[model samples]
Target: MFKIGELAELAGVSKRTIDYYTQLGLLEPVRSETNYRYYPEESIERLRLIDALKKQHLTLEEIKERLQIIQNQPDAADEIVDKIEHLQEEMKHIQEELLELKPLLKQLNEQQIKLMTKPLAQQGYTLLHTLAILLGGDPFIN
Candidate 1:
């Protein structure tokens, strides 16, 4: 356990910022017998995440919501790992397919290459939608 000053220093944040997060129910610290606030080691990571999200331009409320989801989902880490592994496999397959396509691409004329690329560029939006679905929908899309 660490006192607020120590935690703030370790997390590279100000004590006032930690206090504000505590007030907002973002950080929960334990009260010592002497009534001093003491944060656990995990608080350092939480503070870092809060700072990173703030840097990403998320509102405090949005950050709180995202953190709440993370806290509530006990199996999220496992799920994320599985998803990452699956994506890696998919990427490997795509890389192999790209290698196979390389010879065909070399034979294509400029006009043929342009036509092929235009459709592939349009498919990028479809890829984005697929990614959004895989990622539990777009939270930042308004």
Candidate 2:
């Protein structure tokens, strides 16, 4: 959970923007008994999606409607949110593993690096495509 300021900083937006988004029903923050609003980490991904849409020339009203449609889908929004959390965890683990392997990877020759990545290239492209889709980009892009 993140406070408004924390979420604003993390999401690369202003607190005013968050407030405006909350008002527009784009961001849903939980209010505690003390009246403090706490945003989930998933909000960051949502903010990313909103930014992506805005960049594509979507107005707040259109984005809100689109989000409503997405939320109305039975289990689809929930499943995607759950998947995003799981994917974030997986990405953290992969980042840690990559850091641990950095030294060994650095020692590999060009040919050896190519040999190792050959099998992973397809999987890497698939992951990229999936992420692109999640961020509302064209999946067909290389």
Judged by lDDT, which candidate is best?
2
Poorest 10 consecutive residues by lDDT, candidate 2: 74-83
Model 1 has an lDDT value of: 0.79
Give a tens-digit lDDT track for model 1, residues 1-142: 9999999999898999989999999999999889999999878877766765575466999888878887787357345445555766786897798789879988999999888878866886777687676545774477
Q: In terms of TM-score, how similar is model 1 to the real structure? A: 0.58
lDDT of 2 by residue, 1-142 (tens): 9999999999889999999999989999999999999998878978876775575466898888767877677356656556656766788898898788778978999899889877778888888887678566676965
TM-scores of all predicted structures? 0.58, 0.53
| Alpha carbon lDDT of each predicted model | 0.79, 0.81
Top candidate, metric TM-score: 1
